[model samples]
Target: MRDCGRTRWWKGAVTIADIKSSIGELYAIEQLARGASAVHRLHPMAKLIATAFYIIAVASYGRYDAGGLMVYAFYPAVMMAVSETPCRFLLRRFLPALPFVLLAGISNVLFDTQTAFFIGPVGVSFGVLSLAVILIKAWLSVTVVLILAATTPMQDLACQLARLRIPAVLVMLVAMTYRYMGILSDEAHAMFTAYTLRAPKQKGIAMAHMGSFTGQLLLRSIGRAERVYAAMKCRGFHGAQRLAPARRAAAADWVFCVCVCLFSVLFRVVNFSYLLGRILV
Candidate 1:
């Protein structure tokens, strides 16, 4: 019975080893749920166009335009709600980029000598207001990009880029890199799990071991890439991955695009405060 127990323990250990070995496949499974919303059904090119226009408008406007930046957020907020992307998930993802936004906003406080108004004893400096504008604009731009990425498959995005006259090589590189990132993430996770299981608790991983671990990962990745390439070649791959082109954009997609563009332009060009002052007069 003692011998049988030992054999069973070893068998369980081997099963974990097998799971770690196939970690890449596991990671790919996780990515399947990333952008599973109905927004994905919209035309990829239309999404790309709207994203590009939004970015340009935000970037081109004056950094002191707080009203403009506030208006810009309305579009993305509406889209997020309508697209069915979980707001909590989007917020979580956006948090990482917040620090950099704050850093840039700090510069506006330090510089820009223009004074805007006074809040009680505290004078409202144009510089500080500019900083707020920058942060808002940056947040809105990032949100749009995130939405585009979440909704569109990487392959479909690449195809859209290709149709937009972007270099084929660049499109291919982006497509392949995006596709393989999940694979590498899975591989790394599996390796770490296996190493943890085998190593003694008292002799935990050290910083010095990372170099060796990274080297091994690179070697394994290279080997896998070679096998994948060979398999593709065997199946008549001709330098580019083949995919069926997406269908034409429907009327609904065109309507969505037009509405977004018109609203964005109006938001940027029209000053509601000035209009309100005129109405009061």
Candidate 2:
């Protein structure tokens, strides 16, 4: 019994450590956005426009165009290199969305198994090709968004949205949600730590207690949000809260945006990967 208790205590400690680490990771992108890299210095709108174009180009590729989509990988790679954003951090962020993507992609494998191509000895199905395309699209799409977040501060993003005349409610929600995510995580961490201390013999909050734990967390978050809203009201926060004005795009910003859009167009229209294979052969 004593050994079992000791094991549970160690497991509880590890749970606490995980909570603390997650709280830190919640703000890791914000920290990266504060860097002085050249990518970070470009106007936010330029980056936003470039990202939009790149996403459109990626989505335009057909299900069997996995070879063409490979060229789009350069955008995220170059952005990460130029912005000096850590690959590990972006990869960690990328993983959570992958399961959902894989679940959707796998359905194609099960349903559309007609042969699309063949190797020297084996046949490759259209389903397999589609799955590859889905994975590539998922990676490219998620990585670009992560790069944008890592390089551009959330406040700047909010301001740009407002400048674009996006509805006030959406703009406020985006800003407030981004700002409050860390606070919510911290609250969860604190609650988790307290639970661990109180139930030292428990490996984690038991399934029986999970409902109560989650309900209590939601209640706490709501109460804290009420207080925060009150404070904001006291400071002149109306129904609409616009962030700082975005700076005008400079010549360099224009050049960067044009270059990114052109690159996306060139890769989308011309199958560079196919061309390279032909040249090699």
**In candidate 2, which residue pairs clash?**
none
Stretches of candidate 1 off by over 4 Å are 1-38, 112-115, 198-205, 273-281
lDDT of 1 by residue, 1-281 (tens): 86556545555443333544444433332353255555677898888898888888788788677765666777778778766766766776677789998887887788876789888988888989888887778788888987787677677889988888888878888877666766776777677777877864413333457688788889989988898889989999888666678899999888877778777777678876466567998
Model 2, runs deviating above 4 Å: 1-20
lDDT, residue 172, model 1: 83
| C-alpha lDDT values of all predictions | 0.73, 0.87
TM-scores, all candidates, are 0.78, 0.90
Candidate 1 TM-score, true structure as reference: 0.78
lDDT of 2 at 208: 68
Q: Given candidate 1, what's the lDDT at residue 134? A: 77
Write candidate 2's Cα lDDT for 158-223 as tens digits.
888888889989998888887787778778788888997898767777666779988998999899
